[model samples]
Target: MTRIAVRHLGPPRLTAGLDGAARLDWDAHRRVHPEPRPLTAARLVALAEEGRLHGRGGAAFPFARKARAVLDAARRRGRPVVVVNGTEGEPGSAKDKVLLCRAPHLVLDGATLAATALGATEIVLGVTDETAAESMERALAERGLDGRARVVRLPERFITGESGALIRGINGRRPVPPGRKVRASTKGVGGMPTLLSNAETYAQLAVLAGLGPRRYGSVGTPGEPGTVLLTVTGSARFPAVVETPAGAPLGHLLDLCGTRAGEGVLVGGYHGAWIPGDAAVGTRLSREGLAAVGGTLGAGIVMPLGRGTCPLGECARVVRYLAAESAGQCGPCRLGLPDLAGALAALAEGRDAAAACETVRRSARMAERRGACAHPDGTARFVLSALEVFAADAARHVDGGGCGRPVLGVLPADTDARLRLEVDWSRCDGHGLCADVLRGLVRMDEYGYPVIPGEPVPARLEDDARRAVARCPGLALRLVPRAQRGS
Candidate 1:
């Protein structure tokens, strides 16, 4: 693999001292910041409109529209606050972490420029990881921005990365979102309207500021110009961050990463779908391109599943992991994920195929769009995509005892380990005390032990989940906060 220096300030570098350096080398860098021009509000809006810069935070909302919303709302309700969201809690995805650790100054440049344009004074760099927080802090200090921006290390839970949840965490509350629809751009930290976006999006803004609309429009497709950073993991030779022009061919990327001949490629991270290796023949790496293949450029994570690992087994492992990560806020996700995990386990162990498939389908339908957060929906997406991409494997598992391959466990263990609530099957009896305490979070299975969901507990329901944790009969259930859990 290539040993490239992953600096956040500019292009690839060799000096390790430049890892957290603050000097903005405008002329040396390639795409992110080709020049040192300050991006004004009008210029930014124009560039956003021209480049069609979409939010890289999975939602894919138009950047121009979001800016306008914040601008309009700020005009009506005084000034706004710029929030650079570095709280990347998604498992199996490390693009944000890579950017924050390597090129923090680029991200800060974007945040500062955006704040300047929006006429905002205060800036909050919301991060989940300690290393990222330190890197960003160092970058800020290097630029003498101690009082201008504050770096807040948020709870590293999956749901805590949600816009509302991050806002709540910044406001000195647990990193869980309220049940209501609260837009951060309207009422955020300190009751000030906040313009929040992913760390990479801000870095892109810095790039746009440096390279104007027309020059920036010259690299990628007509609509979405510039390059996107992708974390290519699973089965690829070089499992690192790759910078590719938007709308670049998927095949080319796979070749660059030395992806072995595989069954399919998982696009858009865990929440993303899979496409047949042949189907990705001419696929481009853009929102429209991914949409054409029934996928998305979600946070730009692409993983190639090789032929050695049992696809069905890997799917089961991922589904179980996703179920365990649920916040346990809504009834559908909290009650349904464990059942779904059980069904998947059965299928992976060569059980009833029809029953397993039905369970997965039903669980996905129930979980999708039914949670306070998108965790359930994303989990469902992962499961459904597995069903679509590995149909043959599912069929094989149904007929034979197994797929004749090992599990390999390539998805990600951090999320699974963090989210899993171990139950000693040999423990006394099915008291169902945990279920009684944490209503929506834990439900009594046939053998009890309170099967919990994979999503994060909603802000309002956290107290109840905690109560269940406290009242576990066998002391089997433990709420492992991400920080305590060492994620």
Candidate 2:
């Protein structure tokens, strides 16, 4: 691996006022926090641009740019809606959930500001857990923000947390991506332009609103200004959600968590990449800093793998879980993920080791850029990086019987692959529209019962798949994400 040297700085902006205070209610919140600025769209955009604030969501998109887009669209299309996405779907991530629970008022303040900027009278908050939802609701009532804001309990599944999926759920449809490109800034819930961002982003926005541009930009690095919330877990003594400035030293944070040099670290999350344990030390925690070390600040997740566990076995288990979590609307994600997972499992168990390893590599390649979303591609990256970072251990699995270690299963895969695609036998008149619309993903069986590929439809072809679904005359074909469906 190449050595990229960079200086590290300490982060103190976001966590500055907390002082270890956990869960601040309305009264506690107002005590320390200052009054937010009287926000207009232009003022918010200027402040965001000056602070160089980025979304805390996995994508790390420019918050100012996104806000501008939504505000612009609203100018032409009347008042838009604002959505605070508190649904933290990434298993390794807890920052959003924590912020929603502990500092619900801060998040709501940001949402209220954003709603005002967008000329939106309604603000909807999407939360996956009961605690977050309740906290938000109480904050709304206490602030006399009722009628203007609503709390929605979103599905706890992984993929359902996508912005598009959240919009679908808000529209009273199944919480899954529409299998096509739909910009939330242009057409979101209730078919109106919407401004949606993650919980941490809203909190940061609240802070920025209170601090203004200069004061907010005082702490973090030049390129990535402001603080970020990170969920540091796995093998660490102090496994908790932390707030730090953007450019804090990765080594310093690891030391605080009692992580050492040899223990492997998984930066980002399950969908993130793995790097050599020592490679992370001294590196900065900003997006550019992590990228310099061949990692991303994805959803602000950093997990350490202790030397005791078998890396290959651990990788295999995660691959399997990711396979099972597929939305089943994308063929490449559905089929390729399971195939890669099977290959990884075989490699871990020392069964057909060389062949399985090759299959895993091949399947990962085929799955890349083939899904409706980045799920398959991200899963592939995680597994492939594991194989590279733990090459010696991988060799042991192939050349020797196995690593002779236990699978710790330290990574969190809370949900099962209970979600599947089901065809209604009674509704099918066998018109074959399903097969005709989605070419490679769906086929016609002998009886003309649209033979659904037991795999996930690739994301690239999701629009066609959705078209096939919409054109189905019998209404027989339906995409089921889990065995037990929710409204």
Candidate 3:
């Protein structure tokens, strides 16, 4: 595991000091913010606009408009609800988690402020990470806010953090995106207008409320004022959670994290585009700044694909994980995503590379705008961007047998890459029997090949697992006990 490196390029408001993890107790937290001041609904919305605050989540949606919408809904409907989205589900992103763990009170202050202004009696904080949940619980306890706020543990799947999905999970429904669009602001938890925002976004709000826009907006560019937290990982010397003012040079961040020269960087998260090494130079960090360079400041996940790693293969690994983690409710999840994953896998393996590349592009196109949520569109962006950015490698695989470079597994995925259910890809013939006999333990991918999750077989299923292994005609399957796995 890489050691986490936390650094701040400017004055550290969010992170208390250079040595990160500002675990401030209630009294200490009071020293930081002096407690939240009362702000009317319209005043809060106006402050968000003046602060130029956008969601720290991938979308970077304007905070003022969303708050106003929730306020309007409350006027027409009933008193609103507030949900602090602490479910940092993106495997590549950790900024929200870092804030939840280190500055729990900061996030709570923001949430409490929003809840009070919106006249929301309930402030449900949905957190996927147990540690983050624990941190919020501790912060709430310290503040003696047991009655005002509550914490709900959410599933850690890739799509479970979507607003509707999180609301569903809170509402005791399965934590998957709805089959169609359901605006949370209009009808969220218990059919009340909900003011839901990412945890970091709320923290930004708290900061804005405290600083009153002018001092808060002093550091960053005029358009995108205030500092932003970025999770810079992959191929960098050390994984970093950096707090830098907006409009900082993208190259500077890459260099700050020790990103190697001439390596492609995946801007945003898996749902973001890839920028070439040359293109990354002098790129800025704001929404427009990244857009000028064909990039998006998605969830603030930035990773440089290291030299000697097969970028396409690494992307395939993540896409495969993404496909398997789908809600499986819409056409994209049921068909398009699986096909995209399989096509990318074929491209990575050099099997029908020309046809596979075409299929990959076509699958991405087909998946867009055909889903209940932005999952499909975001996934399509990830796939099409890879094709465009890694065209040279695709061309190499198309003409030649394969790219000589190996997939370094640099990109993170939800699946644990443990030594458990093992398959000799060289010998596997898509038997389809493993899935039928083992049932949930082993499932077949779109290509009829087994898509074994990285989990140890349960003690009760050991015999069934062995039977499936024995039944494999090509002798391609086996289960390794945890003892032998060096766990």
Give the candidate number with the greatest TM-score. Answer: 3
The number of the candidate with the highest lDDT is 3
Candidate 3, residues 349-431, lDDT tens digits: the string is 78789998999999999999888888888889988888888889989989995889987778886453333678889999997
User: TM-score of the candidate numbered 2?
Assistant: 0.83
lDDT of each: 0.73, 0.78, 0.82
Candidates in descending lDDT order:
3, 2, 1
Better-scoring candidate (TM-score), 1 or 3:
3
Per-residue lDDT over 183-295 for candidate 1, one digit per residue giving the tens place of the 0 to 100 score: 88888888888889998898787777666777776677887887787878888876766777788888888777777538888888878888877777579999989899888
Model 2 accuracy (lDDT, Cα): 0.78
Question: What is the Cα-based TM-score of model 3?
Answer: 0.88
Candidate 1 lDDT score relative to the true structure = 0.73
Q: What TM-score does each of the candidates earn?
A: 0.83, 0.83, 0.88
Instruction: Give the per-residue lDDT of model 2 (tens digit) for 1-487.
Output: 0111111225444444455565677888887676586688899898888878888888888999999998888888778999989888877787787777777888888888888877896999998888888878888998998898899887777777788889998888888877897899999979888988998898899898888778787877889877777887777776767777778887777777767645578888887888688787887889898888778888788888888888888888777667656676788765788678767877898876888889988998899998888888889889888888898898898898688988787776555343345678788898988766654345565565665644344444556666777888888777665544423
> Alpha-carbon error at 325 in model 3, in Å?
0.9
